[model samples]
Target: MRKFDAIVIGSGQGGVPLAKKLAKAGWQTAIVEKRWIGGTCINDGCTPTKSMIACGAAAHVIANSQEWGITVSDFKVDLEKIVQRKNKVVESFRGGATKGMEKTEGLSIIYGEAVFTGEKTLNVILKDGGEEAITAPHIFINTGTLPKIPPVPGLDTIKYLTNTSIMELTKLPSHLVIMGSGYIGLEFGQLFRRLGSQVTIIDRGKQLLKHEDEDVAAAVKKVMETSGVTMHTGANVQKVEQIGDTIRLQFTANGENLTITGSHLLVAIGRTPQSTSLQPEKAGLALDDKGYFKVNDQLETNVSGIYVLGDVKGGPEFTHISYNDYLVLYKRLVNKEDTSIKDRPVPYCMFTDPQLGRIGLTEKAAKEAGYDVKVACLDMTRVARAIETGNTQGFMKAVINANDDKLLGVAILGPEGGEVMSVMQMAMLGGITAKQLREMIFAHPLYSESINNLFMTLEK
Candidate 1:
């Protein structure tokens, strides 16, 4: 029997960091993982996807070099090479995480699947069919989510791809059919289109990115359209079948029979928590109806000395947001510092062609929250900086409390929208006013400097 001060499971984004922080605090910390360290964010999600997108973007630039007063004779993309590069990036960080953890004192790394045999006792199933029991005062669950494939008829028969399996594609599809309009689907659609694949996206909703502000979502939709990505909303996909060499998608759109056949079919609907394998019921831990672990503010579960954090607990599922959970829980548990997941303005980004970033409340949210709201928006075409950069394709919007003129939320949809939202995120979190942004001098010839002018254009 081995004893630990704290045990963290699933060495992904949230678990590894939590284990490291606790070990550094002189606690006997142990991190248990079923697969490689650094989890999905490094292994599959953000890192590999972004790296592939970068290659696709570079290929687009090369294909359109004539527009930049440069001419190219022969241009071709080696899809396998791009994938190899992406793998290198994943491997680089995975090795670093392993090596770095090796240097930490009072830290033990176990390569096994952990389940609760009792409240404070975990039964670890080793890779080679050996089992060990470990006891800890506190436990953290950081297992992330996996892509969801709905029970569409014949979907399994047809060769399909998800976020996990798509990276294995060795050649570009002549036409790619994507079955969702969420961030994951949209981002991949853009990437494939840039890489010279004709893309058609089908969503069951009335518009793309239904969760985003209408104006921002519309802007990204327009950008994708201009870049040759066909989008269909209110789409009902009936079945997917392999018609000889091509995969055929049958759907109903606009009350008409819609059939699309392509070389690849990608199911990017969404993800669900990967907690099914953990069998949490044996430990007296209750999961919400939505399949997420039920936890209090301090990340403690119903079971004493057991804590659950990250995507398994279910909130905004961002890698950095999980890291923030690590900070809050680690402080309270090991350092005796108190923190809670409340009143924090979390900024989220959709990494599409023009990108989209939003923080705090929208005008609709602010008004619904019983505050008089004022709104301001400036199109990128009207901004001198954007025009100079030849990237005038989006807008900047601000929502303010009408009574006190305090900044409420800001949405940006344009070049580096994610970077531009950081300023407004800081303002919303720190209680800065709209007037402060308008009055402050920003650097010249930069896209973000347009924020000052956006606030100044307010008509309330």
Candidate 2:
């Protein structure tokens, strides 16, 4: 058996950096990856998807160029070239991660699937065919989640795509039918629609982005609808069947049985943690009812020396959250500092045409938490930047504490909304109040400048 000071299973966002830190701290470390080097973010999720989104966005802008008084003769989406470009971006990122780890001393990259054989020992089934045993006192599990496939009848017989497999398509789909209207579904739905596919998004929930405030969700749905993306809410998918070259999806919506046919079906309902295959029971670890590792605020599992980080622990599955997991663990274990995952302001962005960026609590959440809240809203149509750029379709909203004028949360659903939300993220971090933001001098004609206008609409 080969032994190391630390063993990290899965070279995900948290694991990769954590492994490097452990090794640089002068401890021998072994990082095991079953498939790709950079996990989902680099290999399948963020990099490739966003690259395709960019292509789709460009296509969209060019298609509508006539509105800008720019005469365009003809344009067509080259799916082969788009796929090649996305692959290049993924390879570049993966290669960099691989090289970074390779250059690090005292760190070995084990290409295999690691199953816990004991509390401190792991047996790896090598990807290239071999077996090896490794033991370490400190074990970190960052084995992220995989796309969940719903148990729809006839689904197994048909060739359907998950988020990962869809990236491999070299030809644009004729019609794309997506299950679930969550962030993933909406982003890809808009992306494919912009890429010239007939896109339809179906959701079992009553509203798109059901977790958001009603107004916020409505605004997103409106933008998507205006862009020609069809939506079916309160839709319960009953079964799926392949009819020759097309797929027929049967579902019930609004008490009506309905069927939709499409060239491709993407199941983006959700993701499942990879803990089941890890055999956490052997390590004296238990998963939650939802299949995530039951972790404490410190991200430590029930096992004393074992830690669980990233999506496998299953809170907010964002790349930044995974990175924060590494920081939390590094501070506690290495710096001997007190830190936790509790009550942290989690920020996320959806890369839809007019992106949706959100952080902290929503108005509904603030009200539920018993906060005397003041809400402010500003339409992007009124923003100088939005009008100038001709992308005025969404709005910006801020929820503030009525008692102390403290900024509780913000949601920006406009062009470059994510970047605008980052500014608010910093303001919240600095404890800046709604009044302060309203009076602050922001650079003119920018999406962020709309924040000043947003807070100005608050009832004093």
Highest TM-score model number: 2
Per-residue C-alpha lDDT of model 2 across residues 11-123, encoded as one tens digit per residue: 98999999999999998999999998999999989999999999999999999999788978999899899999999999999999999999999999999999999999999
lDDT of 2 at 185: 93
lDDT of 1 at 11: 86
* lDDT digits (tens) for residues 7-78 of candidate 1: 998887888888998999888999998889998889988889989989987887788788777899988888
**Deviation in Å, model 2, residue 392 alpha carbon:** 0.1
CA-lDDT, candidates in order: 0.86, 0.93
Top lDDT model:
2
Worst 10 residues of 1 by lDDT: 209-218
Tell me the deviation in Å of residue 197 in model 2.
Answer: 0.6
Residue 458 accuracy (lDDT) in model 2? 79
